[model samples]
Target: MIRPGLTFKLSILLACIGVLASGATGYYTYRANRTMLVNEAGQSLLTSTELLGQRFSAAIDDVGADALVLASLPSTANVVQTDNGLGANAPREQLAQVYASFMVHHPEDLQIRLITRKHYGLELIRFDRDADGLMRVEGNSLQEKGQFAYVFDTLAFSPGRIYTSPITVNHEYGTHAAEGKPTLRLGTPIADASGTVVGVVIIDIDLAGLLNRLQSDLPSDYRFYLANEWGDFLVHPDASKTFGFDKGRRVLMQDSFSATKPLFDQATSEVLLNGLVQPGQAAGQVLAFVRRPFGSSEGSRFIVLGLARPLQDVLSGATQLGNRIIRMVLIFSVLALFLAILFARALTKPLHILAYAATHLFAEHAMETLPLKRTDEIGILARCFDRLRREIKSQMDVLHNKQRELVHLATHDGLTGLPNRMLFMQKIEAAIAEATRREEGLAVLFVDLDRFKQINDQFGHSIGDKVLAAVAHRLTQVLCSADVAARLGGDEFIVLIEGPRSAEAAPGIASRIIGALNEELLIDGHSMTVGASIGISQFPDDGATAEELLLNADAAMYAAKSDGRCAYLRYRDVIEARKLKREQASEGATEGREAEPTA
Candidate 1:
């Protein structure tokens, strides 16, 4: 083969370099843009999911409030006590109209009724929305609901407590629009004047309609998802997948999206899924799921709410940028190929400089090494590299700062900037360990604000929050440098005092805290006075572990409250009182046995 000339070789080599550089740059830029877009979309979806969860909770609360309103009505009680609407036609008719009006305004309310316990939970007056409109059900249309859990369970609860039934399809006959539809029933007991549960005011909520209303304001493209605490899909994009249990099958969120397993396990409160990192059906979507507490039950009842958007929609801008990058790469490669034949010798020096700058891109004063001032193609490339480096470094710095902020937020209370229960437990455990090793004693002071609920009800949570923050501030001020104070959530705080004199110093610190809190506080043009009941538990004497110490301290705090507010009680005193009461009970039992006759 004939040997190639120097110009030809240089041109070919430059052409290869240009093509490789352009391809690599274009690929990396596309990748970076896609990643950025995915991150932003994930955050946006997560926010939407959280907002949806909140809206769902608020909607449930509103429904419960409505049930309360109907339950509290004098006419509702009067009609329920009248027994099958005899001699109570006027009140029953008026209540039916009220129910009809509510159904008219709230399209999600499928049926409203007043059912009494006397007639085996017979529906006295019922209004149901049908194809015609809201209408009253009379005569044979009335059904006995005492056998149903919604009626019996509701009657079990005292008045004013709303009982939420498990969401299920309403198979009850003669339900009109609610028949065979997904339904949630909220029932509250209606008590007579003597405080007896006479009947229940029941409202049947159309689950699908309520969800539609909740998501009405969201984007049309965003698909909504909902699952019960068991991870069974209550709502899904595919209609067949929802309520799979009703069809003698099972469809679970965790099975569909493995990333959501943690949500069902209760390991995490939220989950974010990226399609790029996922497979199968999830491969082209970004999804977020948030766990929301459901109903007013004290149990661990919750629902998982999710929102999903197509990945293609989120990367539309990146797609456009990729197209532009492709065009740019082709143009630059062609230009480099033509110019290489003329400037083959001249380009060597700048190429070395660029390579060195690339290696030291993040090094201090590295920009000085780049030939940015030159009015040449190499200079333009160098300037672009510099810009990229700056942007990358800025992004990294911001990421680090955000990571630190997140760590702080996870451990501290946002409202008061104090260590929260989780962080406090960790610190207390470590302190306890150290104290046990050194044969030293420490004190845990449990502080609870008295009448805080009243303050919240009287002035609202805004003023109450300010008062809590003020209390937290005073707690910090009253404690010594060796001591730590933490908020244990909602008008309660805990303190740990280390050092040899911890047990002796705890009483004084608690007294000071009580004094500090008792001082009048002026907030939002209102003067407010709040008092705290404090309890002290000594290390080794009260408990051997962090949990024990906290429990004992909490018990002592309640004892203080029982004695009177604005006072301090010690765990030792609580234990002694319990022991004395036990002894007294034993003595009474002995006396009763001794007094028993021949048997």
Candidate 2:
């Protein structure tokens, strides 16, 4: 059988295990919750990115349609008029009014330009705004401008039906240096009534505004860039600063090239690899490119629109979610620790009480019972201890009763059933201390029966015992409840009177005791009478200690015996004189005997 102490130790071990297990479980749960939160955040970022891309594409398409409308206007057409004088003298105000109307219709299109092809070369009669908000005329030979060189050299050599190229241009008419601004240029042959091409109409649509507006709707952490087919930076939100003057020039490329360089490398690679316009790409596969070919052109006019988010930013919410999960787990751990301590204390409280009770078992004063109040194993142990306590108490009671009997036998006279000499002296000491404490008087009376020897000699020891019993009974009757009457030995007795009112009180009690003993008789049907001589000593006057009191009382009793052997006497001057005389007579008789005979 396992001891209670060992059982308590095992319970503590099990409780520790439970705490550790709970902590482990809480940590696992926290980690799982954190992972789920991060994954959900990543999914949301991806979804938002796709929606923003669609919105940007729609915005660009809307702006492109408006530019196409302005290109179709006859007033802005590049055809030469049959009547040159009227056409040349036509009011520039009338053309300005038309341009103003176009600007009002397309509020987001920041700039529009018109270029005309002539037999000599390409003449650009462009209406563009300067910083002063005035429309300015820009003219360029088709051979001089690199932007129009693609139209004049390539298409004019091949003589395509209509040609368009998406180009990034710098509007240098103003001091602002609007650098790396993307524009869409459309070139169409101006056909006469006989179907001969007289000139080409060129439309320049500023794509910078469309790209800027598209970038504005993107999230703050996101950045947008448009690059040409050669991986050259075309339209960036910071294009004016990053591509201004000589800056970022090494990274720009013309529109016809396909091999990507460093700056537009990500866009070109995404467009080529994903083939965004291809039909076979999976629906859920993340596409980094969206390609739209412009103006029925083949390769040169294709706009490779790349849309992507940095993997870091897209998964940033995962980091936050993980941290949140960790924080929650930490909080849960703290709570678990707190609860564990509380539960451990609650579980151990009963065991502590039981242990305390068990410790008391070896102490000088043991507890009567264990104080456990639980109903589990601890309570059962307490109940067992209670039973053990009962058994121990039963044995203690038996031993105590036997000890009391032995003490009584050792201190009492067997025949008279009165206190023996040892008990008498002890009682005398107690009485003296009590009288001294109370500042009162106590009387110690030494009692001796006068005819005790004669009764024993004549009627045998059995009759002598009856006489002693009778005298003891009479003494008990005469004494007050506060007095102790003890048989010193045989017929010698002592009575202790506590807190006597006066010396006269002792005499009255003495007289009553003598009278009661004189009336006691009828031992074995033989009438008997005995006289008791009692010598009284007063506390603080006759004696201050038990021995002194007892010796003085004995002296007084002997004096009573010397006087007549019947009446009690208090030790006084007359008794002292008689005692002195008896001592002197005994000495003289001893000297005479010594001198007269050697035998």
Candidate 3:
């Protein structure tokens, strides 16, 4: 049997590797795109649900406002308190007409009534909207509603306070179009002139109609859900699932969506669930739910509103992307196979040369021997390698530059771009060592801004930061080339001045700094004046070490503030004051000893 040559073996190996790589890349890209789309869809659904919940709450508020308007009217209270006699007929008729006009405008309101606390919650004036149109219930047609919770519970509420009832199926007799429909009731109490609870103005809302109005603009693919505080479904995509408690079975929202249980426990105000990790019916959907306050009632009442869209629809773009990726992967695999065969034939001598050059890539003139003159695949590969080597060198240069920048940043303040406290200390230590060797005088100035806190509190921190930056610029302008300045925390700066006349020149430098800061600053169209108190300390005379000099200068700075700010003090004065106080105390002790009895 004849065996394959080296070129054939190499071609087969390279082709297999390319095909595997292309397939893996295609799968990873499809999966990543699909995940991103799913997450975005979940967030979008959540926002829609929140918007729906807000709309529902606003609708309830609107109904309450309308009820308050009616309850405040003179005719409603007049009709409620007066007996159903000839004297009350005109006001009752007027109130009935008002209710009719309101019902005509708000078709979602099934019924509006003036129900009294007396006569077993008698319906004084009632208007019901049915299939035909608005109908006014009169005389015996008006029914007593005191036995109903919407009437009795609402009567107990304080005057002007609105009440909202739980959503339930309306089984009341003679409710016309509202009979047997899901209803929500809103009521506000009416008080007489003496503040007596006379009656209530109640508006019964068709729950389905209200939700339909709220979701009218939503897309057709979106499904809506609503649940009471007890987690019972009030509205659902599937009609059979809604009002399950009324049907003697429980199809609770928490039971349907396990993640939504937190909403019932008040643990979370909203929930987002996706089909990827969920099971059963939720396995191919993205759903979001938000809890909304039902009304301004005294009790803690709330309802959950939700929206859902199919995950398949959300990932449709990702699916198309996956199809394109698959086609590209097939095309690349065939191209890779053809190139592998071509490379197997031409790779022999150049491959050895390229391998040797790669090993010594950084060596001097390693690419000088490449076959760059030939216009074939080997020459193209050599040129590509040269370009890659240049790019690698360029990247190394960029990395080195970044490292130098990081070092500078480590030593400088981010806000003022001046040396920070640590860097200042390092600079001072070096200056102290040089001064000690050369016997040169060095001065340390501790500068503190006057009334900076007041400026910060009045103008805010943004302006204060700008002031600090300007102050730093002024300090740099005022100092000599050899001198160093640094920020030592908030509103405090330290400066190092060296040379022969450092001690004598320290005060002049301090005066110049104070003058620079004292000038009025025109920041953000606000003219403000600032000043500085500086304390000067000299090397060898004040203290030998950097820390000792800084401490002395800080003490002197406090002295300047105590003596009235906007001035400079020297550490020598502080030391003399201490010496004078000690001498005075010693003299007083000697006088006391001489004047005492012998003992």
Candidate 4:
């Protein structure tokens, strides 16, 4: 056997340690750098998306304000007064000059027309750009705009309020807008001095231009996406996919990004997503943020704005950073191992202490004394071990935090932040066992928001969401801390009331919830009132199981809605009476038919 020198043995040992330490440090640093990069990108994109939504809204509002201002101008009233321009002189020069100057300042205004309700809808004074983009008054080219939805829709709106038409191609015959460029019509009901609806002042907005204006100041690498209320990609980077509805293709943002499906539903206003962005690409992924700009606002159908960047582009620096760190680590490892061999004799005493400490490696500050006593390569090794332990603990803590977040998101409703159907059912199962063991009564109230659909249809989904949120808040306020309130998706919510005395307690609680929600909700400057119909089912009385209770409560709620909404009803009492009445009515109708004629 060859008796090797102490320095030679130490050199071999430190060399082995350096290799392992380099690999461990390199991998940990790489992972940490990548995570940090992704996190920074997420935060940056989220903030940018929020800013973009605000900027988009401000852009639309500016155009709407301008249209209102032009509508209020004296020249607009003059043009409307001269309906059927075949009559006395209409002073067309002043109106032309007004539109010309306004169009000059707001070059995106494609066409500004004062269309009077003459011959159904007559363009009394039309201001449009020529083929060369020069402002011109086409009074001689007057045409009928009665068939346009924008004209008819505006006539119905309150005066001074702008009603924006759906974003679509300019198919109208006499528009200055290019044949296939995306366009939106902003119409303001022009009422003269006497509050009489005279005509509609319409402005054809170049949607493409508006979007470009919104994107002008953004990063060059960032891509913009615009979708309508139905998720149709109105503006896409791929021009072929833009206005896919007009081509009968039905291309949707959700088809590519399922995470943004709820953007229009108002359930998810803003969300960060990561995935294959090119419609059909495997392996590669990009990070994107989708946000709805028109949050609880009137005018203009909902338009969702999304901004996305390639993930690799975001993490470009991480690779370089990792490489540099690995190289530095390798150089340091080589140098430290060389020095470790020179100090091989000094390592003996500390090594003895370390061997003793290593026995209790998992103990708190196990090497505390070693670090304080030694000032050699061994001390450096001890400090590195301590740092590694802390790093491992930190990573473990991060993993645990992520797990907790995942569990929370899994159990809670995205909207209203209430317990979802699954979680609620689980709670009900537990509550049932508890109630059974204690011989106590448990009541489940099924609540369906009444007139919610009407609000969504009449106003918009944004306003509807506000009303739902407000109603949820009010319902929460009326419930005791022990009571459990959960959203069963859509307009349905379930509440589990404990320790109910008699059947009246459930009904009383339902009544208070109904009354609280029925109070006026001021959403986006609109005073809206929504109500709920609640159905009560008690444990061991109406139903013994969660499913049975939920079903019976739902049936009673329907009865409440049928009888007259904004009311609460008990399961058996309300349903049986209605069934008996229906049976009696059926019997009477049968008797009448028998007594009448045999056809």
Model 4: CA > 4 A from native: 1-29, 87-90, 135-140, 275-286, 293-300, 324-599
For candidate 4, write residues 196-253 as lDDT tens digits: 8788888887778877877888887877788888888987778888888899788988
Best by the TM-score measure: 3
- Show how many residue pairs clash in every candidate, following the order shown: 0, 0, 0, 0
Reference-based TM-score of each model: 0.50, 0.39, 0.50, 0.48
Q: Taking the tens digit of each residue's C-alpha lDDT, what string does model 3 give over 268-335?
A: 99988888757464878988899888675454678998889988898887776689787876687676
What are the lDDT figures for the candidates, one per model? 0.87, 0.60, 0.87, 0.77
Query: Mind giving the per-residue lDDT tens digits that candidate 2 earns over 1-599?
Result: 44455467567766766756755676677556544544454455445544554564455445445444544455544334332211243543455466566655654444544434444434434444445553545333212232445346423522234455646565444413233455555555544445454444444555666566656766665545455554455654455533332353445433322322322433432232122123243121222443444453333444445443444444455566556556766776786678678777966776676677677754424454454454557667888886776688789889999999999999999888888889888877877777778888888888899998998999999889888888888888887777788987878898887765756688898888888877759977899888888888888888799888888989998878887877888866445787899999999999999988765
Clashing pairs in 4: none
Candidate scoring better on lDDT of 2 and 4: 4
Q: How close is candidate 3 to the true structure, as a TM-score?
A: 0.50
Cα lDDT tens digits, model 1, 171-208, are 89888888889888888999999998999989999889
Error of 4 at 17 (Å): 18
Instruction: List candidate 2 segments past 4 Å from native.
Output: 1-332, 338-346, 349-376, 406-417, 433-440, 524-526, 576-599
Residue 80 of model 3 has an lDDT of 81
- Please report the TM-score between candidate 2 and the true structure: 0.39
